[model samples]
Target: MVAVGAMGVAPAAEPNTQVPAGSRHYAASDFPDRIVASPAQDAATGFAVAWRTSTLSAPPLLELALAGDSPDMGRLRQITANSRILQSENGTSQHHRADIDGLQPDTLYAYRVQGQGTWSAWNHFRTAGAAGQPLTLLYFGDTQNKNLSHVSRVIRQGWQTAPDARLALFAGDLVSGGDGMDDSEWGEWFAAGGWLLPGMAVAPAAGNHEYFEEFEDTPQERRVLGGHWPVSFALPGNGAVATANTTYWFDYQGVRVAVLDGTSALDLGTAQAQAQWLDGVLADNQQPWSIVVVHQPLYPLRAERDTSVLATQIRPVLQRHHVDLVLQGHDHTYGRRADDNAALPQYISSVAGPKQYRLSPQARATMEPVAEDTQLFQVLHIDGKQLRYEARTATGRLYDAFQISRDGKGRKQFTELREGRIAPRDCPRPVSPKGRDDRCWE
Candidate 1:
């Protein structure tokens, strides 16, 4: 049995593996379901692609083409030859994914996926505007542990708050068990966010949870996890942990969004042994705004306070890069910490699910009741030189708002929202409050 720790396992010949030449097969026409866009194909071009397949043999041979304005298939622009691959897992039926490349920047492109007997209705996505253009992105935190109940709230409320986010970044923890062996959780996550998926790109970071799940007790765990990962979403091959498909970099108009997988940092060390790789990547920057995201938060909230190792090891690299913004999860609550070099980095953490956590007083003005307990999420809008950030509650109410402008040039300056509504006192405390026991179950 392989140890269920970090998922850095090397592929080897296994006698017991049940990989058939082509086992489960689904006609795309029968179950025309999920179609996702990921892994920007070109780091320098406006080309991006997504994949879709049936539930059987599930995914189809990827057939791509340059889409025209008209939804009419015959009235299209260009169509590439059929490109396809099959990724099977745990026996739960799912189609693998593919990405389209060599696209025109700032243009709308339509695409569709096909399988055994089904073909998805054509969906459209607008390529990111050229660099320096104002843009919007939706940021979400750990949908870990439970999804059926908690995740639905986050996704629904997020859709309510900002339905037009060009992209949605799930800062890791897509599933628990440290892995995708938990087929139920994975299915629940996809089910919960099914509404907005076809229109939005789910850029995921592999959290520690993606590495967990039952190996033998459940058939889902027996053959899924890693196989499903690559097939699920087509991400940019810019990240170094492995290929551009795994840990990669991308550009969104004026800002350059860099995504790293911290869960793979300590384990996939040699993959990034090439010196100056990150430096060259960041130094060769041309965008006005730069933001980086990963699974572990550089600035953890109250419920999570153990980052001595991560801080000591990765902190220096972040500082040297002068990276503009960093998005993360795993702490489970919303927090903002700034002031790098002195002690902790200026960062903000938020909980996206209803299964919440209590906050502490490691930082002043951050004790429970002083912060927030409501399911949280954030929407960032970059317009010209002014960048605006808004934090909202589950009911679509504003919690915090700030607009940062170009004054420091390299340093960030904040301008408080004079009219934005901010909430107060709705969270748990470090020391249990009266009447309620320190632990639940009373």
Candidate 2:
């Protein structure tokens, strides 16, 4: 396990412990969970892609083809792409990816891999266009523990309900990483989503659980999660840890999504380093919607207002650049503080996992976009100059919804502010699953 300081990481390990019926042979031809799409390097013309393979081998190299049977694509020429190999720590195996470039703006493309002498079934993804336009994206709080058991149900439900969802963002604490690679936890994380992640665009923000313990001699921080994240999903490579390869940023359609490592920024001595880079990234990237993702919420659900560490550190930069949205997870409850800035703003804090999520008495009394121990996700629809954001639980219930419309450059408006709170709820209090405890959920 790699040490992530205060933040926890989801450890990667072999299935020696958690295979159903102990079927290790099934590893062949099987793909691990955390499969999702990310925008490739070229903000204007490319999108990067990655997915996990059960048995390790050389990375899959291949070209792309649009999967849909649209008349427009029939006449379009097929594009060739290059694939790269990545290794996972669970075992030296293949984590495949292709940087599909030269794609048409706002157009959809499908692709497959050619490696180990086998051609993978064609997979599909969409590209983002340049310029000012309202855009849509998906946000999930945390999928850390209870991955397949509950997380799978939540993710599949979200996909089933919103098939058109172009992208998915995570708030972190995605898996409950124990002292080392707890095979059961990692397996649950992947099995939860099964193959759904590959079909949707998945963008992740590093939660503490996403880190792993690495040896002290190792310079790149933790290697546990380092082994899992790279090939599990394909992401653009313009982030803070350019040389390290973990933190990076990308642009989708007209939104510039910058993923910052909160765990590092807080204690890794990368504060000044990343802060400097962020200043430039925010200043240089001029996308219509600027979104930042990190594990710890700047506006914590239960922390003291003045003591909220991250908010004090990054909120100024966000306000200065007029960032449109800030997404986060950690405090395991649903919360939203609209227009938080002294002037105007939109801040949201939510959770999507099944562990340690609860609504405090104080939190419940305040009301205001509150839900207890709820598995929820946010769906936003952007068209032209309008942005509509809705918060919904895993059961497909609309808990809270609102709209923030922009007229043009530097113009903002708020609409339909829903007041009140969802009934309070809590996860079964933590208890050893090995022993009978009411807190443990079977």
Candidate 3:
């Protein structure tokens, strides 16, 4: 398991031996779980799907077809996928990925994956059209849950807020630990997303917990990314070497989403390359709106944490390219920067799990509408020159709302400050005699 340091906030240790609670049955005739879809680098032309099966050495097969009246089921096109075997304590499973291309723009296609003896239910996903279309997307913070079902509510609420979301971006730490040791956590995480993942594109970053064990000749505290990060989610491979799957960029409609691997860049020896790649991607970005998704925040809210290295190296690129939004996680708290720095993109860091951290005095003083002991999710809508952002709690209560738009003279402006948001809550501090109890969710 990877170590998680909570800056100045003391986070209670989760039970190390605890296994995920819930269903773990997978028969040879059963369909796959942990199924996820990723938008192709050019979403208008293609998309990809990845799934897992408990049957080892399973053949890679996917069937896809355009959904229409009187569709010919016998004519469905079958595509062979690339497969690899992953071993875990739960058992051995095969992860398969298939990238479907030569697709028409703005078309709806139905596809399904197959196991050794059973086929998954057919699911449909819509492709993006040519540039210049409105887009709505969901953003989730660190969902490193002690109990996967706890965060599952927030995920469901997020979809309720924006049912038309084309993609869901996770700012890393999808699971608490067990990067490879425990496969049950991944199952639980996938169970939390359920069928929603198959319909929408998923873009995620690699957090500290995504890495397990220590690097060669390094201290145990220093870890490398887990084997599953790349295979489980076959992201765009246009990122830096060795971090290709974890760090990549994709475009949908008129928005460009660049996912950066903060764990590899900061701890591993890939910061410089990632910095350069970020600049290149942003420099070539032609989208009306540009968004950067990273695990760690540039201006961290935690008192003892200072991501100056990321701020100094990457923030300049975002500012120089006029990136519109910077979505991030890992602080386990909800807050937005209050500084009046127009040059930098708007920063938002939120949490979607049960873990809670007390906001530092400085964070409470400088950040606006901060929330502790709360699980939050953000919804972003982009239409032409206007971008709307809203942060809501797990129960669908509005916590913060704002909009950014471009003026006639090509100047960026903030307008339409929706009010009546409930004030932030600071949950009672640690109280259990053992000091390991979780009261935030209670």
Top TM-score hit:
3
RMSD of 2: 7.5
lDDT against the true structure, each candidate: 0.58, 0.63, 0.79
Query: Which candidate number would show the highest lDDT if scored against the true structure?
Result: 3
Pairs that collide in candidate 3 are none
What local lDDT score does residue 110 receive in model 2, on the 0 to 100 scale? 73
- Candidate 1 segments whose C-alpha is farther than 4 A from its true place: 1-32, 39-71, 75-94, 178-181, 213-226, 241-246, 266-276, 341-345, 363-372, 407-412, 428-442
Model 3 TM-score relative to the real fold: 0.89
Candidate 1 C-alpha error for residue 319, in Å: 2.1
Instruction: Report how far residue 306 has shifted in candidate 3, in Å.
Output: 2.5
Q: Per-prediction TM-score, please?
A: 0.76, 0.79, 0.89
Q: Give model 1's TM-score versus the native structure.
A: 0.76
Q: After aligning candidate 3 to the native by TM-score, how far in Å is the CA of 219 from where it should be?
A: 4.9
Worst window of 10 by summed lDDT in candidate 3: 20-29
Candidate 2 runs further than 4 Å off? 1-35, 41-44, 54-59, 68-90, 130-134, 179-188, 214-225, 242-244, 302-308, 360-367, 419-442
Report the C-alpha lDDT of model 1 over 262-347, residue by residue, as the tens digit.
Answer: 65554444224312345556777776666767777665665446655455565565577666567777666666655455312346
Candidate 1 vs candidate 2, lDDT winner: 2
Alpha-carbon lDDT of model 2? 0.63
Model 1: how far residue 77 lies from native, Å: 6.3
Instruction: Score candidate 3 by lDDT.
Output: 0.79
